[model samples]
Target: MKLTISDLAKMTGLAKSTISGVLNNKDGFSEKTRQKVLQAAEQYGYVPNEIARGLSTKYTKTIGLVIKDIANPFYSKLTKGVQEVAGEYGYTVFLCSSFEDHHTEKEQIQAMLSRRVDGLIVAPLLEEVTFDHLFDLKAKSVPFVLLGSVPGLDSSYVEFDDYDGGRQVTEHLLERGHRSIGFAAGLPTSRASRERLRACRDVLSAHGLALRPEFTFEGAQELADGVEIGRKLIAMKERPSALICFDDVVALGVVKAFQSEGLRIPEEMSLTGFDDIDLMIFPLTTVSIPTYEAGKALARTLFGRIFGGPDTPPQRIVFDEKLVVRSSVRTAAN
Candidate 1:
């Protein structure tokens, strides 16, 4: 025997019509009556048919979040932030992982749109996200907030100062007297990677230091990719005495390769990485960005647009990145 609205009304000794008004927040329903209805519904363990309610309200009060990789701790933190804020606002979240596949990203976005989620938070797969697939979402005027970098989108986003992070790391190594610095660049097609590489170049140029074309190798930010880059560096005749990796995962891989070669960190070579993910394993010199805070701010802005008021200026917020000095880098002997 399933409990329905009528059962709830009967259990509360209220008329069904009165119960309906209170449940839907209809005019002329006092807060006292609303509480009574809600209490009865809770006591009876009554679950409202939200599908029908969505048809009436034209909204599901649900948000869809898409991440490129769930295994990455950075995205996990971002998801946590979104979930925390979503809970605060009484909204439900539907999370999906694209696995860095553009095709999967397209399909996920379509499914979310078909379900008519109130809004979406997307971390684009690559720099060139297929705008055509997003057309239906745009046509429907669905609100979306971009989490990571998307070049020239002119949309609302919350991202880190990746360029500054790159420049800061490079300069830190340089200040420690490291002249032959190698770089483990991520996929150049990614906006975030591009910004990081640009910052590396800019900082090098600022100091009149020439960037060795052979020293700059691009790869995925995974640990395996880092190991591959490490092997290539180790095999060089005159390898770089220092390295700046794309992210913490790559840094860990590089450390593995270095250890395998019996090359000590900060003793024979120095290294720096970006995105200071859980440093408990092998603390590395890196930059820590407020990934979770960025997510929360982006959600706040998106919620504001969906429920707060009419459109305001396109909000572009960049969270600060700080350098975490650790035992990964050594002062190069002059």
Candidate 2:
């Protein structure tokens, strides 16, 4: 026994079209008529069907958000930021995890698009060079903002200053008199990873030193990967005096592995990490990226594109990363 707009119209003694206009908040309706319709609807406990309303207004009042990994604390903070802003605008967010897979990312994007979300915030797989799926989104005129670097794709995005962060950490290690350094890289296809590795190399080159190929390890995204890398480093006949990890998670795993092997941090080896996630109990030196602020910025930018008309210029915001020095790294013997 659900009440419909026609029932509301009959109850209010108004035309069905009048009832619809008033309920939808469309202009050209008198205040008295609007109030009457509202009162009637409230008396009947009528709830507007969102799907039906969307069909007429063309807005679902929902947005899609896709991130690399939901399990990552960085994205968790970022998602919180996005949800906070979305709540203020009376919009719901549909979150999806890409799991760092290109095919999965594309499928999730299509699913979100099929649901007719008002806009999207994506952290696309930067490992793959092709972005046909993103191009398709643009061709379909769907508003979206990227959360990370996607080289050659001229789109609205918010990214971290990974290069500078790399330099900061590398220079700090160098200033501590540690010339023999190692880099634990993330995905090789990631532009952020490449930029960070490049910065490390550049800084090392400036100091008349070079990162040894044998010491550089790639594909260290998870804790297990870091543990494996740590075991490999321990087995090495000649290990670097210090290591720079891709993220805090990996660094934590490495620290655990090193400690289990009776190696003391800073005294035996120094370590640094990026994306200073709160999960780490170890006082590891790392770069802190403002992931929550970046999320808020992404939502704000996406809304701007959604409501600011098609002519709204694309914006690219880059947040600088800060190096948080801690006891994990100490001055090396000259």
Candidate 3:
């Protein structure tokens, strides 16, 4: 037979209320009494009835995490940080993938709510202008954070400095004396993709350099997409002296195409990437975001909202960016 809180209370010679207080780690219980109730419960092998406890407290102690895709190293690293912090705080994270789609993101959010999550942490997929499903969770008073910011939404978020990341790559190439630069952007609807693109274009414009339209490319954030873009660019008669890729994973494909066509890196055309995904063919020079630390911050922020009550002001944590210099780039001497 399973032991109950009543059994522990009887053994400890304490009232059920006192036992409840000790079990929940509530205040007002003396340390000595707290230990007495705890020891009695431990000796009797008392297991908490989570369902009953949730019913009484009106909180499930679970959090929801939604992202674009887990396969990407960036998202995977972020998930690790979230899982570590969530476990330490005695909470389970319910995860979902938006697949960068509005309908899918909405359905996943509804499913997470159905599971009675205490709060939500999402890397929302939004356009800079006119996004769908932006208000799905806005009406609810539950605590939530976006891994990235959304336009016209009043929620706390942890956003990477992707705009600066884009500029760093372009400026790195320009400072090396390469005037003809190119950008390989990811999905058009993705805000992350757009921010990076805008920064690169703006920086080029600042230097009185018009980013050549023919040298540019846009594709999925996939390895094959990288290879195709790389091939097309290398074949151009007036190709860009340097190509700034969308991401590290796609950059792998880009390198493969270049190597296949006997185009030596840096010696012929320079390349750079974003997100700093590990285990690459060459030591990649790219913009590195604090993925793990940001993940920890995201978890901490969500908990603040969960326990801090309705009046707690939202925390918008913006993470910094850095340029990881490696052997992948060289000076372009004209």
Best candidate according to TM-score = 2
Taking the tens digit of each residue's C-alpha lDDT, what string does model 2 give over 265-319?
9788899999888777899999999999999999999999999977788899999
Q: Where in model 3 is the C-alpha error above 4 Å?
A: 1-22, 25-45, 128-136
Of the pair 2 and 3, which is ahead by TM-score?
Answer: 2
What is the lDDT, from 0 to 100, of the residue 291 in candidate 3?
91
The candidate that achieves the highest lDDT relative to the unseen native structure: 2
Which is superior by lDDT, 1 or 2? 2
For every model shown, what is its TM-score relative to the native structure? 0.89, 0.94, 0.87
- Residue 250 in candidate 2 has what lDDT? 84
Cα lDDT of all candidates, in order? 0.81, 0.89, 0.84
Clashes of each: 0, 0, 0
Which lDDT tens digits does candidate 1 get at residues 1-334?
8777788877889998898788777889888888989888877788887776788887798999988877888888888899889999988999898877788888999888888888888887663546655555545567888876455455677888888888888889889998888888887545677788889888988888866989988865789998888888788888788888888888888889989998788787788887788654776899998888887987887897688434555578888888999988998896
Please, what are the lDDT tens digits per residue for candidate 3 over residues 169-255?
888888889898888888875667788889999999999987788877875588899999988877778777788887888778889
